[model samples]
Target chain A: MSNNISLWLRYKAKLVVTNVSWGLLTFSSRYRAGMLLLFLGLTLALFQSGNPRFLSYRMVSTILAQCAEVGLMSLGMSIAWMLNGIDLSVNDLANLSALIVAMFLRSIFRPTNETVLLICSLAIALTIGLAGGALNGLLIGYLNIPPILTTLGTMSLFRGISMGLTEGKTISRLPSALAVFGRTTVLAIPTPFVILLLSCLFMYYLFSFTTYGFKTKMTGLNPKAAFFAGVHTKRAVFTGYIFSGLLASLAGIIIIGRTLSVAYEYGTQTYIIFALLVLNLAGIKPGSYDVLALLVAVVLLQTLATGFYSKFLTLQGGPFFNLFLWGLVLVVVLALSRAMERWVSTRS
Target chain B: MKLTRLLRHEVVLCLFCVFVVLSIGSINPAFFSLATIFEVIRGAIPYMLMGLGVMPVMLTGEIDISFVAIAASASLATHNVLIRHLRYQGGLAGYLLIGLPMGAFLGAIVGAVSVFSGLPLFPVSLGFWLMLYGFNLFFISPEMRFDLPPGLTGFYRRFLVTVKDPVVGETGLHLAIVYVLVVGALLAIILRYSTFGRGLYISGGNKDVAIRSGYKLGKLLIVAMTLNGGLAAFAGILQCAFKRFFDPILFRGAELFVIAACVVGGVAIGGGRGSVPGVLAGVFFVQLITRGLVYLGIKPVWHQFVLGSILLGFIVFITTRQKLWVIFGRRKR
Candidate 1:
């Protein structure tokens, strides 16, 4: 018993040391600014509750779910960013896909648990996602429109169609089986979390290992260099939009499945904020897919939200403070990252 | 020759005018009646306000997405203050004085932040937009119902234009129509003749050179935001009075439309190349399309969709100079 206890203590010491070193590395990174925010957040959470336990497991889980859609959306956004363009219509496309999926299920499936119904729903959802992407791709790729303007137009067009179809109403009454998939977990892990994990892994390999990913990032870093290097810039941009559209569709499915409803206003106005935050938090760069980094950001934001909720009960415009702080945080982080890069290079 | 040049250049505005007349004429036939004409002009006051406010900034090649939020906050502040103090029914003039400044202050705060932050206007203004929106949501009942004093509510009716015909008798025209004209004329003069306006063009046309040449670009930016804020407030006050209620979602997507008008007015998105006249024409074009849709009784969703598509088309058309996308024949394979 004495020997076993000593062994356990030694093992625990190693674990503690490992964690300390990892934390230090995080502090030294450009992402250290985000870490600083997380530290501040955790400190506030503790201060407000007089205990670190206030940031409960359920709260973390809820935040992970909140970040999941944005995380998925960001993967596509990061690709677009890597390809030197942005798709402003990401959230709209997600909402449109959700609305389309809900409509399809309601009209055809008739609330079934049958294998066939589930398969059909999945296929329909994926196709609608692709179609939404394809529309953006067509305008941007074939028509040779600037991505900024093309996406802006599609953003409005998709949102209008979504609202028009629903007449600005929510589509609830999702099939119970699908709702189960949305909510169910293996060992307390939600389906969306699992999907998020798999998607991240897929994107990691797509961006890190593939020739296409290499070309995409190269194009983004220096379009002239990439063009001279013989990368098909138009096709790459088109692919990026399609991927973005697909991710949005997946987000829509997850949102509807989780919420069991879809509405015209469901995903409106969230694209820019979520995308901007996620891209910045993930330490966006050419061909870099850091799941750990994004996860950290998700946890940090969620904790901040909780801290804000608990600390300020006053209506003297406290809620607005969070948005202001978040926006400021984004700017500060970007500026700091730029400075840090310069500092690190000088040291090297 | 001058008349011909004017006609040629103002073609878009003329086309819009024709579109408005035809649509209104068909819808109620009475739509072209004296009262209806005045009503249409009165209704267009807000868009004109936005167009005029944004013209100088767009000419500088920057965009402000914070107009609606600033406007909404100003309108709400005025309403809240008026409700507390202006309880005794005040005349139209009384409401205007209180409401206008309330909006201007809110706008100036946004302007100050943008000028000081040294951040891109799009993201920084977006921050202001969200912050103000949150405050507006919580300040009023989240559902956003404001109750004006009987006198103030009645005073707002004076904004309507009154017209008297030999056969039709008298109909009212909104005082807002005059506000639009005055504001437009003021902006036109500044754009055409003022050094301050020239500073805006130079700053937007080339920021590095503007700074190198010793122009106080930062101060000029503040002035732009201040004017934009003031006009936006005026538009908000007018709109809130016209609608007679305050909703959190009021003007939710209005900033985009305002920017669209600026773009359609042939103001380069990159700064330093558009005229006030062009912006006014753009406003007329947007107003005509919206009014026409309304006259056609198009559903609200379809209207939004069409507006979105049209806005997209304009941006695409404006941004895609043929030089940017030349396809080398050999590269296609």
Candidate 2:
């Protein structure tokens, strides 16, 4: 027993000394994430200095409310990204799901049974979401279409269906009770924020503790290797897309709650860009996605957006400035993180 | 076998086009005119050019979304130079001449960023897409300009052929058809006949094989991007000329649409196995499907749905036949 214990201790010592080296830069992605956090703090401070109202509780609440849709979409995007794939159809899919839910809710004139209607609409949203995701999964997994191409086709398809159904008309004034998710607050935190928290925790638990999560990560890392090791790669891909679809659909529901209206072109072109930017900044990967980092990234984006809108609406071409900066930041962050990795690797 | 080999997707497209035209003609004899066909082809020029621009990049086995940004910036910059600064718009020649190199330069920057950042070309291009568009809009010009230079004025009516219709006044083939034909032929020659173009095919088909055979992928990447940028600029300029105005948001949401149309035209998604004519036909296929709906009394809003469904179904059909065949054969065995 003494010899075995020493062997284990020496093995751990070797791992610590020669392998990991117990340094901060060893995990460069985490280091980059930390740097991003520092940058966010500095930005908040700078923006606050520029305008004292930038750090108010009301501002924080609004930021939380606004980030809910994009945060959820990014969560869906992260799942697709894990399989070395993308779901470009997320925004459109979410819009379509939201529009369907609105159409369903709008048909009922009397809201005597508000909770039942909301529940039924939610069921409809989940069904549409899962169906949409399943289609994507089938094409990608069974038909072997490229993920980008698959999602691209589906994105337009969803957009078309919405347009065909509504003839480009916006469904306005969804049942007031339906928009409750956008309105109500529990302890000063908005309902949307609560939903976002639930989603993050759900994803975290699903990813860290579930067999589905294991399969997804394994399949993402290497489908061929996973298959050899008795993993059902295709099923994993299918289920992963289903979850993505589910998340996007939920985002669509929240958008309806916030705006109480649904249009075929809700998120449009820039929505996907923002979600992708969030994922890239968070350094999201298949096996080791940091949920906290993702949350921070979403909050950071909302803060910047709110700051720009409130403080600099008149300067530097307004919202386009944010887009420009995000683009620059994407390039800069990717380059910096990679360089940091190289530097750290070459150092010791 | 060789004769049947000639009867591939393009041949199928020709038949499909014929079927659509005839069926629509039967429904509305007024729509059966050759003039409408000419109009469809003419309208497809901008899309064709965009498709052509991305073809070379796709041939290098990389997807590029940055060309949209390049086109936006190049044309907008050129417009700013000609309209805002120089105020000299003598003719179409000046626009093309200035915009071509501007686009190529922008495209080369995309290639360089991909190379230097050591990231996959997709994400690098995505970054450039957002960065360049936002940069141009914020720093360059946000408001669209409807005023045209004196030379480009009335250029929208310069049809090569005109036919008087009792109902529709006059519809004619646009003179821009020459541009498409010329550009298509040039690209075909480059892709099929040139040794350098052959390098695209090799590398796109299989990267490792190309490397083993000693093709400089980095150089190819840059050159292909440059070619793409130049073509995109040309398309942007042409679109502006045809539309009779310059807009900051020109081609704002056309990236995915153009890519999808090209893929439907039989440009393989993973690259290395398509032709210039094939891409043109793809664009034509898409144009007919979307535009022909109006003639068929289908609401225009349903056009997106048609396009999406066709794209999805076609991709699955094109890619899955062999897989299905293999599965069936295994079952039989």
Candidate 3:
């Protein structure tokens, strides 16, 4: 296994370096003001402290846990975007699923077993989440509506449902097992991180090793050609949204499960963040490895946020600072990719 | 048939209004009273102002989600002027006139950042969003809340037209409403007749081609943001006048609503291809849906769910090209 992993790493590393070097050689003409700014940001962050090492793992873990719901939503968001579509309804859908789980669990079961109830609750959450996603997929794949507008409409519609379900009250009688699942650490790592890793692996396999994955990419790259090649482009698009919906639901489940309660305000604000992060960091590929890469990007961003907080900077409203940095990062990454694409095409 | 199809989109909105009128007519019969109807239209003034301001950007297939935040921050700034600075003048018109553009200029700065950053719409807008919120809090006391002067409130109330007859007459109108209508009309005319508007369309339709054709894409982007920013500022001050206060949370999460309105009006996502009339129709449609659900005695939560579901359905419908088989009804199988 070690040998295979090392070989795989070497091959990937060579592939990346070759492409990057070729890009540098070709698009070397255009000035890179944005990249310079990003580098400056990094250097500033790294050195602007009595001791910057204080921005360590513990701080990062806490920040990741704080922003995990949106981070998880970005995993699904990237897939929808990979198909050149976006699902703006992700936050509301996630919220709706959480509301459903909260209302159902509270109404049906008495607050009892920590373990058995936890598993059951998770099952319910997953099922409801999948249903919401499927609903979005069916609408998009079959109806021929634009994803942006449809998702925009659905964002409000789904939030309405979630809000309706709870009658505008916070529900908190979640089982202890679910709480442990959310907050507990295994081998000194948060469970959400573990879940994120497993999710990345699953996405990697789906996008890299499967025929469906290839078709999804083809549909994104050129729908006309993909359709001519006998690929059901609409179905691919449909499946993409559904999968996004499912991921959103899962994120909702994780978030609510972690908090052991669900609030109406929980998921509304994070929609844009999840969408922006995935688009900026993951490029436009819908593969498992890309998903994992996005997860790492989120982790890196969390690390940066930690560095900001620990350095005795006015971390009061650190989120605002983090977002400003995030915006800059997005601009730099997009410009870099655009330049790289131009360089590669010119070389070829 | 052609006209109907041309008006197919408006059909839903019409139905919603009819439902509202009929339901209120049945329940409180007086709900349609000129006074009450005026209240409804008056209530709608702020949203209409925002919709008008944002329509041009949407028409060119761009969006300004940060506009609401801009409006909020601008309004907060205007509040400081009206309350703290203008107390010396005792002159209302100067304060109102100056506050309007002052708010817009702040919004324009946000627009400048958006155009230059070359990022996806969400991040840059969100950055400004947080800044605006923080600025509002930091500039004003976080715990301190204030009210608009009664003089300004009296002006809106006295001059603004209210609905005429509850069941069969025209709805209320205000000076603010007139401003909104004028803005919308101006946008429609500009988009239909002007070179700048056409340039915006071309830029949105194909950025690369526009650049190749010698259009300064960066400058155009800045212009679009400027328009969006200025409009946002105007919308913010209007809200302050309408609501009689600069509540920090007055328009929380309002960007989504504005975007939804634009999208429902058939604005394309990647810049270009929408109309001013379509956007107006879209805004009214959204408001109608929200109001109708309440009139029908449905719980407000269901309205939110329905809004999301319908949005998803419409987004999928607009973004995906229909399959040949689906269009030809199974291809003669």
Candidate 4:
């Protein structure tokens, strides 16, 4: 019995050591930005107001809640940016999908069969997302329009279609079933946060363990070399956009559920900025740790926003101040990351 | 042969512009009136100015989307100063003196940052765009509308030339038309006949070769971006003067429209292959479509959709047409 106990103890010790080493390796690769963000977050939480409101459970949960949809969109955006492409239309795609789902839920069905309605709405939203992504992929990959311009055109196109369809009005009173995924909590965690965690895991797998992910990275690193190596460069580009679109649509579903309504201009104000910020802040070589980096960035932004709002509740132009702060953060983060890269390169 | 030599891409664009105008006029006779033409020209001024600004940057193989934000910021600052001077007797001169240089300075900043950072122009400009926009919003209330001083307003409303129309009321030509003509002509000469223009083309065509040839590429980029900023600011001033009211969102998406105009006019986004005349024609084409849509009684929401479609179609056509022609020529051979 004692021999068996010793053996078990050794096994446990080996497992713990391997796990800790794996985490250390992951954190070290992204240590510069990750450490900076953690320091900032902790500093703000501890000292921003001297009241320590940021350290509260309520504040933590609020930041997580606010970050859910934006985090999901950033995950999608990172995939595209990993391939050295961008999707400026993700926010609009999310908005359009949510609007489609909202319109159907409000006009076509009663709330009698919640399960069936939920399934149908989700299917419709996903289809819209897939179709939008397919269009972007074809235009960019097959037709060879620059990603920026193609996405720009589609941004306007999607926004215009949503405006026309909804006549610039908000669609509300969505079925409770739809809201469950966004609004309800499971074991004290927000449903949207749970969804985000699950999606991040799926994305981590898709980007790390899959052949498609390998092809995407190869294509982004050097399209000419990737092509010569028998990777279908165009197809890789196509799949990148599709992945972005599908994820954006998933974000849309979460948004509609959380807000309990859908508007044409939903997510217009901040998702693009957030996505760009997270993608740039995390510095685009995707790995398992990227998921953690994105979450940290999103929470950091949300903390700053919430902190400012609470501290300056009566200030005029408060919202604009938040926007200015976000822009400043983006610029500073970009500069710092670049400087760090140069410093590390020189030292090495 | 000489006539054909003159008929390059600009001529093709001009012909397309004429065709659009004539077709629209035929559909609605009201569109042919002098008032309609002047109206179109007035609206086209801002776009033309922005295109001219974007052209040089494109020639340097860079882009500056922050011009719209710079324009907005300049306009807001000028408007605030003009309002303060309302108690004192000052004309448009005070606004111009303050606004023009301020615009140019802001443009120079954008250029300097782009040159210094060595980052891609698009992302940097996007950062500036957001920052400037937020700055403007913080300083000026977006919803508040400020009227120009009465002295400047009266002078602004006066027509440089007027024709009395018994049926359609008085159709007066604004001074903006003359401004457009002078600016367009000056830009055309500079682009076609100036050493700076040659440098821009060479740098854009082949950066390494341009470096070998002893051109100061960084300075050239700075100058091009500064000029773009100044022109955008001037356009913003024109927009405020024409509208006689200041709103923070006056030129919200004007950058995209102006860039679209440049692209439609055959200005390659990659640079080194565009002319002032081509850009001007593009400005006219976009303005004509926008105005024509109004005359056709289409809903305003459809305006952006149609514009985006037209831009996409034009780019696709321009890109593929050369390849198609080459293929047919090879078959003939």
TM-score of chain A of each: 0.80, 0.88, 0.78, 0.86
Regions of candidate 1 where Cα sits further than 4 Å from its true position:
A1-57, A83-85, A108-113, A137-150, A285-291, A306-348, B1-10, B16-34, B82-112, B139-151, B159-171, B208-212, B246-249, B317-333
Question: Where is the poorest 10-residue window by lDDT in model 2 chain A?
Answer: A21-30
Top-scoring candidate (DockQ): 2
lDDT of 4 at A151: 83
TM-score per candidate, chains pooled = 0.82, 0.92, 0.80, 0.90
Question: iRMS for all predictions?
Answer: 3.5, 1.7, 4.2, 1.6
Error of 4 at B331 (Å): 2.8
Q: Candidate 2 on B129-148: residue-level lDDT in tens? A: 88888888798888877778
Backbone clashes in model 2, listed as residue pairs = B265-B282
Residues A106-136, candidate 2, lDDT per residue (tens digit)? 7754346988877887888889999999999
Clashes of each: 15, 1, 38, 0
**Of candidates 4 and 2, the better by DockQ:** 2
Give each prediction's DockQ, rounded to 2 decimals: 0.27, 0.62, 0.38, 0.40
Highest TM-score model number: 2
Candidate ordering by TM-score (highest first): 2, 4, 1, 3
True contacts preserved, each candidate? 0.34, 0.81, 0.53, 0.38
lDDT tens digits by residue: candidate 4, A1-348? 999999999999999997785565456445745664765668575554676555777776777787888887888888778777788889999999999888877787655787877788889899999999999998888777778777877887888788878878888887777878686788988888888899888887876788987888888888889999999999999988998899889899988888888898886846787788777766665322366677677667666667777766677887776666676666666665665555555544
Lowest lDDT 10-mer window, candidate 3 chain A? A28-37
- For model 1, residues B1-333, the per-residue Cα lDDT tens digits are 343355443475567567767866777564566665555566667877977887776666666777888788777777666676656465445556776666667666665665665545665566677767776766554666567667657545674545676534555777767778888888878867888888898998888888887888777877887888888878887787788776665688887777777777777767888876677778767776776676677887787788888887776665553343343323443
Of candidates 2 and 1, the better by DockQ: 2
